[model samples]
Target: MSILKLKPSCKDYLWGGSRLIKEYGKEYEGEVLAETWELSCHPDGPSVIRNGAYAGKTLPEYISGEGRQVLGTHCRRFRDFPILTKFIDARDNLSIQVHPDNRYALKNEGQYGKTEMWYVMDAGKDAFLYYGFQREITKEEFAQRIREDTLLEVLNAVPVQKGDVLFIESGTIHAIGKDILIAEIQQNSNVTYRVYDYGRVGKDGKKRDLHIEKALAVTNRIPIVRKNSSYPHAADCDYFTVDKLNLDGRVMQKLSGKVSEESFASILILDGEGTISDEREELAYHKGDSFFLSAGSGTYTIEGSCDALVTTIREKAAQVRIGIDIGGADTRIGLVDVHQKLIAWKTVRTNAMRPAKEVIQEIGQTALSLLEEQGIAMEQCVGAGIGVPGTVDRKNGVVRYSNNIKWEDVDIAKEMGACLPIPIYIANDADCAALGEAAAGAGRGCEDVILFTLGTGVGGGVILDGSIYEGSGISGSELGHMVIVENGEPCTCGRRGCLEAYVSVPALIREALAAAGKELTPEEIFAAAKEDPVVKEVVDTYIRRLGTGIVNAVNIFRPRLVILGGRISEQGDVLIKPLEEQLRQGCFGGEKSGIPEIRTAVLGSHAGMIGAASLI
Candidate 1:
């Protein structure tokens, strides 16, 4: 029922033809109409609504007036409209160009990089387009070839025909061939770095500028591996998924589909003469027609012969993932929803003295009870992620060892699977906590982070590119085992002067007891440090030694954030401020690479459970 016809914004680039204006029936007064932005909300060239109550309003304006719910829940991930669809008519070759990836583009251009797919509608004889490089080329050779005006020599040119499809990822150097009419579906971005323009001049009678420097930085000089279209989909990528729809008036005169609440549907009429009807109303359609159907628009049907492309945002449902944080005293089970919120939780006594299988069975039963109370079925849950307080062989879902709960060589997944009918994943408790913090805690929005938990022992985890970075052998993230001193103090891990030996809660208490002649809790020691010189020295020394370990981590990973967790981290700024100062002075880059932000973990006890669930 909620369908709106779109009026395209025409472009008159020098390389464009008049096909869009003549054959496609686009109304443009320009000498040549090269491109038509069909379904766009981009500020550069927005499509206008031609029918319905929002007539005469640009797509962006309509979206603003109607609220983002019209875009559907799946679009919640995007800051703006997710895609830009266009019809490109190239009478001459487009400039050879490359698009930066999201990281680089956001830093340099303040926009997402373009990853586009082109569906060829028509092509002239011998039509060919430059893809990536024909072979791997060095940066020196690429620059030399560009300067010598021979870059095309090393480029991979592919012959094109009607119905041919090409997916161009960011950093791929490419150019559209002459005499090709194509439909392009791309990310909502207009940033481009043109490398070669074939001596073309703009309308101002001046040579168009070339972005050779940026092109040199982002271009991928390797041959691109082409892939065939998978059945039922013409092109599929993170940004968009497109499927071709064809209806022959005699054999297949009708087509029907339903747009669900997850995503909106875009119907781009290429060669079609049909009537499209939804639950509320029906409208006639022809070639070059574009329609935007809001999410949950029930069923839609098209009748008469047609050739069209259907595009939809195919994002996974944001379902809950069960997280179980196994501890020595208690097992905390929680349901972390799509927003990484601990929507529901329960705690049960963990009788570690009992057999591992018995303990796991209790934990599993507790999780099932929690789900039942919340009205969540096993099918609705993404899966279960368990955080074991020990070495975990994640590949095999085995708790290799756990000194906290005295678990050894336990098949956690198999035991838990007996009660929960879903996939089970396991990881070191610290690693799980770090993953949780990275996703929704202190390191939220950061892809790389390092978390150090200063608890009974200084446990830590490395999260690189948003995943727990457990290196080869699965014992690699034992951060506390790294030695910072030769023989200063003995560690529980039987190592001398390991980071844990110097800065753990017990170590801090030991230092306080040695200096103050009395045992003090971490909180009391921090409070007494304000007036007591001896206690201040103990705390400063603790900070200094911990800073050494932190500096070592920052130097190695250069993560975007360093998170301090565990109970001792409750010191907040008192701990982070001094450590940050030490890290600024002692880190490898000496502040030139920019210091990673240091912060205390905010998730409290739920970090482990939420992080465990994130494993799914």
Candidate 2:
């Protein structure tokens, strides 16, 4: 069908009010109408088609019968339906919670993460809600405050009014305050990591479970850097783009538009009554009405005064950069668009034991093969960046020294450039990760950022004033070599008490073996720390030492963001919370100077690849 009206699935949450039912005309048998899934394909609650031949069928069922084309060509990249629209009425404070990113949610929860926008429809006097943090806070302080029930003191309580629009990305800690109604459009996911519930109880008379560990893993512990609100469009991002429509009925009683093949259009009516019509069909829409217009439906017209949100998918660009992360064991290469989206990728084993020229040739050939498979031309590429695991003399395109790859004085760029058609650049793999994160991931929007890769060894990269701060010599910034202990553990760099000695994955496992008499994986060590005091001590010591190194880096560089990466970082909040505490205590000047936000690197394994691409 070209135009289909949707019936929402209602919810009777404990903190819900009746505003949606009384004011927005939502029909629900529940005593309290908390939320309405207006346009959704989520398994828990799906919107049903109310009119046309698809009436009584859920949105997913209709889409299945109509074929995927109904969703539009712009939606082809997605594995499932892309967006979910809802209406919520809060009579009391909702829980303080955080949503994970796609990588974290998909790995642990078997679903996509949420990135949502809230349009305030109505609010009571002095109505406010928690958005993020009032200021930068350490994971340690965040946990302490949660246990003390004082989290609200540090949260940024936004005083919202009707018509205000708030875009909440994944990882932002937020809650809806009492006496407010909101229209929310978000990714098609229901994953929420609730951190605090105001000690509230569920129907069973027990406090609702708080996902403290998970929340800590995902919550961005800093005030959101608000964007300029005077943009041409209402809200635009990778998932969906929404535009506001207003017709005064006097000066502009009618508006016309076309539903193109690129994207299907979703119309969420916020206020006023109107008649929406196409060439063959016309339907009356009131407040809270939801309508779906199939792609390529030709011209459509709307008459009568109305305020609405028109949402559609935005297609990605074809132009991309090639990123190559060269490790001793393997190399990961990918194509990343201007938006920093990784379009396609491939992993190839790196025979680093071979001569540098041969390895570079293989990597270059692999990149070319990937491009050919993706139907990409050399002209479409901006350039290629290579992340080498070693001391890289970027200016001369040489690998000065790399113990892992057993390469020294090798011309990586020159060798690779010979086989690839694009210009080539190279840097330390750790440095690439820092650059990638600062450019597009957790450290985006921050001028000064630091990244620590805590895997087999502690590796680091420093971005100061929007550029990598390579020291005066070709030795590069060996942040992991900085001494933390007076004469503690032996480091791989043949030093005593360097940060790497105590903070790396091997270091943690070593400590566990010494203290607990059993060797364990990083995941097992963290899990055991919850129950085994012996393992807890080992983990605590690791965090303490890790914090010491971070404190030293922060004092010297004064960065705004500190990112934790590498394999060990997968522990998430289990690793971050305690480490943040030590940094808070040991950091010079403490809160007097703004504390840098400590976060887990969101780019994961692709950080090196994306970071390498940023060199272009």
Model 2 agreement with the true structure over 1-616: per-residue lDDT tens digits: 6999999999999999888888888888777999999999989999999998999999999989988789888775565788999999999999999999765674477567789999899899999999999999999999999999999899999999999889999999999999898999999989999999988999999999999999988899989977659377788877889999999889999999999998999999999998999999999999889999998887999999999999999874565788999888989999988888888999988887788788888887788778779887543565688888878898878999999899999987777756663457888999988999999899989989999999888889999888778888775688888988888888899879888888888888888999989889999998999999888889888887788888889989999989999888888888788777777787788888878879999888888888999877
After superposition, the stretches of candidate 2 with alpha carbons farther than 4 Å from their true spots are 228-230, 317-616
User: Candidate 1 residues 153-210, lDDT tens each?
Assistant: 9999999999999999999999999999999999888989999999999999999999
Q: What is the lDDT of residue 375 in candidate 1?
A: 79
TM-score result, candidate 2: 0.55
Residue 244, candidate 1: alpha-carbon lDDT: 94
How close to the true structure is residue 57 of candidate 2, measured as C-alpha lDDT?
97
